[model samples]
Target: MIPEQRRDFIYRYVHEKNVASFNELAELMNVSHMTVRRDILALEEEGKVVLINGGIKLNNLLKLELPWREKAELNHDVKRKMGELAAMLIEPGQTIYLDAGTSIFEVAKAVAASNCFNLTVVTNDFSISHYLMDMPHITLYHTGGLVEKRNRSCLGKSAANFLSTINIDVAFISSSSWDLERGMSTPDEGKASVKEMVLQVSKRRVLVSDSSKFGKYAMFHICALSQLTDIICDTALPDDACQTLAAQNLKLHLVSTEREQNHA
Candidate 1:
């Protein structure tokens, strides 16, 4: 398997099992113990896993947030497809709020690439602001606040104050984890505050996430799933998840990828 896929498989396995021995991982992955150690080291470096005595475990700390670059790489294709689907909801001359997240970054990219112009975009993410700098027709507003380096996003009181002032037509929000029980959550309190404010101010709130995010919980809770106007996810999302969202009367937009289409 490719390195990314291998790493993701390891992550999912460890996450599901909560803990795994070196021998077990090596056997499950069909690789040597050395290869398992190497993959475990990579995941350790990413803060997603912790190496214990002869075993590995998911970080499991509710407040541990992975680095933005690391997460951006985890589900790259799924995120891009979700981004494209999210951009379809945007119209011309609208005021938009883009939350600070790697998944939301894809949405910003799709918006930047589209024919939609003369739009005012407000964001707490420095990278997203920088990405739209060359797009002449877009008016970009940055939420000046404390930076959370791991996520490369702005947060704290200054960001919240700025967000409260603006009226957003559509807000694209992302979270580290979500489920029927926890709703939406993030590790950072400041980021959660900013996201909650954006949801309140926007006329429509759309959540952009991949299937991997399901059945997880974070430290800070934002809002329940029913609050969102819509959610964009790939076809890899489980049927039970779809059923849960549907039961809540929430709109879940399923975007099919080429591989999923072929299988169908």
Candidate 2:
């Protein structure tokens, strides 16, 4: 398997099994103990685990990771609000750049509801593209690239080249992790390149992330925290985080996390 695919498999296995030892992984992937150790070391460097005596344990204090689908489910209410707020920023007869992440896809769903006339939506995410295909009122543009099955997204050189050619009114993106030090990040270099493209095309940029993203850093850097135009997060965040973002000269929006049923 390719290195990226191998790493992704290791991540999926570790997160699913709560692995206790390198031996377990070695047996599961049909690899040797030393190979398993190398995989664990790689994951550990990305802040995914803590090695211990002859074993490994996921650090409870470390960032939480969910499957692509499960992540979309976790903060549905907040994401919807974030999506609405992102869409509200849209102007008719303008073009936007959409990065492929759950939060950004939520923004597309919200935008689809609005069906803003004469607005162009450009993206590399298959799920978001399919979502907008039926919405005739909004013009949709897609980039060609190899598809990622889990997230149903596209990436690589072609997509990057496509993004380079278009200037956009706004770009709404999601993050794997965020911290003042490393800024916004992702585990995959391929996706990070796509994000770089989003930044390149956007005249104005917005980052749509949740509370879970704050105080964390991921593998690949897309851009520095100061580069963000605004950050939209849920109200459940701490004051210190809000202060930190403001200190970076970033506008912040706090959306309600509670579902409508609970609000009622």
Candidate 3:
């Protein structure tokens, strides 16, 4: 296997086992101990694992967020469907805010594919800005601030301040964690600030996230569920959760991944 695949294997293995010895991982991957050691060191640097007593353990505390590329690989099809559904909400000549995260990145891709014209797109994600930059019909703006390289986005006071000056027609916010109790939250305070500002300035505050992020909670609180005007996510979200959202009179768009797969 290639280095990335090998590292992915090691990460999944260690995550499943919780803690594993060098010998155990090396034997499992059928690679030399040296190779396993190198991979472990790399994972350690990424804060996904920790070395201890000739073994490696998943870093429960520090592994709250995955790098952008890694997160993009997860639930890829589901995110795409969510994106396409979100794109349908856009109208030509409207100013929209796309939040930073893989889920929102998929929305950016869908928006590009939909051939929407004369739209002003604002974002903090470098990836999204680059993707939509050359489109003749779209005007793209990036929020400049302290760069969070891992997620390929900008955050902090500078980014939040930039957002405060703009009025957004629709804001498609992304979050790593959310629930009924804490609402939407993030581990990074800077991200929270930016998202909060987007919600405050936007006319339609829509949240674009996946089913997997539904029950989770992060360290920093952004806003409550009632703050959102709409939520677009995969249909795999739980029934009870759907009922709760309905009770709040929030518009919920649940994209069907299975239907998309069948159409594909």
lDDT of each: 0.84, 0.78, 0.87
Sort all candidates by TM-score, best to worst. 1, 3, 2
The best-first sequence of candidates by lDDT reads 3, 1, 2
Worst 10 residues of 2 by lDDT: 58-67
lDDT of 1 by residue, 112-191 (tens): 99999889999999889999988998999999899888788899888999899999999999876888887998887888
How well is each residue in 1-264 modelled by candidate 3, as lDDT tens digits? 888999988876664356799998888889999999998898999877889998897664433676798788777888888999999999999999999999999999999998789999999999999999888889999999999999999999999999999999999999877888889988888888999899889999999988767776767889999999999988878899999999996899998866566888
The superposed Cα distance between candidate 1 and the true structure at residue 36, in angstroms, equals 6.3
lDDT of 1 at 211: 71
* Runs in model 1 lying further than 4 Å from the true structure: 1-61, 257-264
Task: Evaluate residue 109 in candidate 3 and report its C-alpha lDDT on the 0 to 100 scale.
Answer: 93
User: What are the TM-scores, per candidate, against the unseen true structure?
Assistant: 0.81, 0.75, 0.79
Model 2: per-residue lDDT, tens digit, 1-264?
Answer: 555665666766554344567777677678778777887788788777778888776543335455568567656677888999999888889899878878888899888888578889899888899888988788889987878777778887878888899989998888857777778877777888988888877888999988766666656778997887988888767888788887777788888767534787
The pairs that clash in candidate 3 are none
Native-to-model Cα distance after best TM-score fit, residue 197 in candidate 1, in Å: 0.7
Give model 2's TM-score versus the native structure.
Answer: 0.75
Highest TM-score, which number?
1
Q: How many backbone clashes does candidate 3 have?
A: 0
Which sections of candidate 2 miss by over 4 Å?
A: 1-66, 259-264
